[model samples]
Target: MAETLLQDPRTKYPVPPFPKQHQDVPGRQSAMQPVPDCGEDSYVGSGKLTGRRAVITGGDSGIGRAVAIAYAREGADVLISYLDEHDDAESTAQIVRDAGRRCVLVSGDIQEQVHCQAIVQRAVDELGGVDILVNNAAFQMSHKDLQDFSAQELERTFRTNVFATFFLTQAAAPHMAPGSSVINTASINADKPNATLVAYAATKGALQNLTGGLAQLLAEKGIRVNCVAPGPVWTPLIPSTMDAEKASKFGEQVPFKRPAQPAELAAAYVMLASEGASYMSGATVAVTGGVPLI
Candidate 1:
């Protein structure tokens, strides 16, 4: 048998000449041109999370789908919450099922407190108890000037990206026992604000703060809370939310000169949720393709 070449984790894909593309809000994975890699064929699990139950918001596609796949392979049953993306959600569920785990799909706008509570309840009822909660769903739009930012946009962004995190975490934490984990998805924008993405960046900053505070607050309960701050990642959100020019140059500022693939982020999340990271909390792990969060 021919030996399969393993890519050096630091240097795999070269800088891509991203083509101009666009999709409506909450874009579909199928519509993406390069079909953002979600580790469907690459990731191999070693039973790190065996028999655990997890709730992942935005689990329909992109980073959320990648995390669901990784967790399932690591021996977890997943309850996915997405916002009316039936086709995308179904595909993710199929991947989880294929990995020999229970996969539950819930569709709703998580901005509402009722829906957030329902999502957690569903996880308890369907998967038994929540061991890991990934608050990954988000909303973003780009504008050239601060003047273009609207009051309506600010409210909508905060409700989806910030409020939902609080609601879901509150709902899921009670059912979570000692050694349970919560992983929030922050962004590079939290550290280095993008003028055009001010609203989105602000939400990410809020998420980071929440992750830190919750880690301290939940310490007595033996629950760990952390955040993943990714730099430019080539996900459905890129083409859908960014302009053609911005999309093409997305990750160029990073030393790697390219955006990260969704698969590239799975390891950090897996570590945060596993027993290996029991002592890790209130930390922001940056997977920014060499862009320093510090």
Candidate 2:
């Protein structure tokens, strides 16, 4: 994996790629012509989450995959809740195991409360307890006009984006003690506001709020809550979720003229989850490629 010019196939390092990557469906990470660079070799870990357990939704690919690797390196056993992306989930689990920690893959939709509860219980039963929870799974579709967005699309987007966050956090929060962390994946579009992804962007706004309220609600328990608002990132979501033209021009408008790699965003997750960020909560880390206006 290291022999070739390890890049995200978008642009220069630390800046992200311009053209988006991935498909609109459950895109296969390994099938990507030029896979996203997840900063495995460069990611350094401290014993922050040693002996801890983490439950990360969407841990199968993209930023979730990178975060799982980082968490394993930092000494946390991870349980992943994801859609049926079997190969990607297995591959990520292998990386976590190789990093010398246990990786439990929990496949299901967070749209269901039952599934959310079961996922938390499985993490506790399999990994001992849940110390960290990251609500990172999401889905989106593009539409030129508001009327073009079907009711089904709006419901599905919100169900996965905002509703899932609330349900999973509700389940995991009880199991988490002091020093536990919850990181929600917000989006730059929440602040910047994109016209194309109206419903999806709106859901992100709710997620940002969820982060804030959860931080306060969990403060009494000594658990910290925060968010990572990434800009145009080159992840499987791009290819699978965007139209062909949109996918090809994924990150053209960013000041850096590129999209962020899933690996680049992984560090933010590690920072928030680890003890080094003990005092931080309810804050958003803007990882957009210098979207100056946003």
Candidate 3:
């Protein structure tokens, strides 16, 4: 018998400081030096979410894209919400359609409450109804010094990262029946704040709190609200926001010495959305690769 060689995810090597690269805020996947792995080739769905509908914000690329692909493969219709990343969004849509599922692309700034509400409405109208809601979209900027952070940036960060979560959930809640799940993308920053990501960190803290409170509020209604707190994940946000030097060392601080590939997160999102997590709510699943959320 021949032995099969399998990649050991635990020993995946760290990415060295990448070649200096930058994109205007909201980066494109095509421009990335090493394209992110969104489980396009690797993940094989087991029909965990068959006959379901999911609405994922930031589904254009990175973890959002990974989750969208996973959900589609699991037999769910997906509505992907993105901010002006038309090409990336189309690419993701194609992947979902390729998976034998329906994919709807809604492009707009999630910062607006109206836009967030519209995301849920479109899902109901198009995908039928929302059974899974993943608030996976976020915005961040690196500012080492407090003074360097602008007021405009502060407001934008909160609006996009925090407010949108509330808006979308409020819009989606009434339609969600018992056994539906809501998964928000929190960050390790909620536990260990990075000095440069103050605003983004603050918003993550807020999200975790919202996740907990809503879990309690929705318990009787049978909706589960949870979150994933990831540490340094290699995504377009790194190169687009950090200077080359910083981006290269992005995942070094973790004991694993490398950021998680986007594909690595797909299982956690799927598990939370599936029926297996029916009894789980208000939990923060830390997928931080070796980083402690303590």
Candidate 4:
């Protein structure tokens, strides 16, 4: 189904113009004009996750791709899941391997429980047990009115953004041991909802609470669970979900007034999954561009 992504260019609204150019969500790092700063050239590893294996959902590009690169840099092999951005996913895998780590790519929809289990199993079989799990795959659509939202679309949104986390976490739990880490991707919308993306905002809110609940549930098992709530960062999902105008103007609302690169958030994932965050759990690390939630 992911292969079908970006097929229907006939969206609810018109794609607007950006200051320069823009790529859609599930964007391609290669195609970006200046290119997205993914820190591949200088992310030297210190063996933080030496001998570890990880599975990063949505690892083809954006924040997910950055995390995959970071994990590889930290001495861990990686398994990247995606709907289809085949070339982008392969490019990421190549980078991981070039970093002297292994990488696996699995393409499919996470909506089905079977697909989730298969992904986990394949990771286990191919890369060994998963020591780090990053639930970063997500999608959002802008709708002027809730009545305009389709039932199918809403279900798909929740299935991919929310249920995928549940299904993957469930599958990964068996293989994870003490000191294993699970990081979920929350968003700025959780605390400050964007009226145009109510469905996405709601799922993110649920995701934040879910992260908290999972933290408590997994603590007894010695697995650390946490979340990263990133404010307006530029990703392909932007252009793909929103119109062209919104894509280029992204992050203009945040305090920083500029979109963050996925690489900017990589350190957080590395810290949470590595030795740096041994005692940290259940906390949602805010990486938003100065959007404070009290």
Top candidate (TM-score): 3
| TM-score for each model | 0.96, 0.92, 0.97, 0.91
lDDT of 3 by residue, 1-294 (tens): 889798665565446566667788788887887778888998999999999999999999999999999999999999999999999999999999999999999999999999999999999999899999999999999988999899999999999999999999999999999999999999999999999999999999999999999999989899999999998888888888888788767887777767888999999999999989889999999999777777
User: Model 4 over residues 1-294: C-alpha lDDT tens digits?
Assistant: 446534331221222224455556556667764456676775667788888999999999889989988889889999999987999899899999998898889999988899999999999999878899999999788888889779888898899999999999999999999999999999989998999999999999999999999999999999999999998766667767876666677776666666777887898999999878999999999998677977
lDDT by residue for model 2 (1-294), tens: 558865544456534233445454868777664677776676777877799899999999889989998999989999988999998899889988988999999998888889999999999899989999999999988789889999998999999999889998999888998999999999998898899999989999999988999899999999999999999887788788777667767777887777777888988998899888999999999998777434
Cα displacement (Å) at residue 72, model 2: 0.5
lDDT of 2 at 187: 95
lDDT of 3 at 107: 95
Each prediction's whole-model lDDT (CA): 0.92, 0.86, 0.92, 0.85
The segments of candidate 1 whose C-alpha lies over 4 angstroms from its true place after superposition are 1-11
Candidate 1 global lDDT: 0.92
Q: How far is 184's C-alpha from truth in model 2 (Å)?
A: 0.1
Off by over 4 Å in 2: 1-11, 14-24, 292-294
Candidate 3, residue 143: how far the Cα is off, in Å:
0.7
lDDT (Cα, 0-100) at 80 in candidate 2:
89
Where is model 3 more than 4 Å wrong at Cα? 1-6, 10-14
Ranking by TM-score: 3, 1, 2, 4
Q: Candidate 3, after superposition: displacement of residue 62 in Å?
A: 0.5
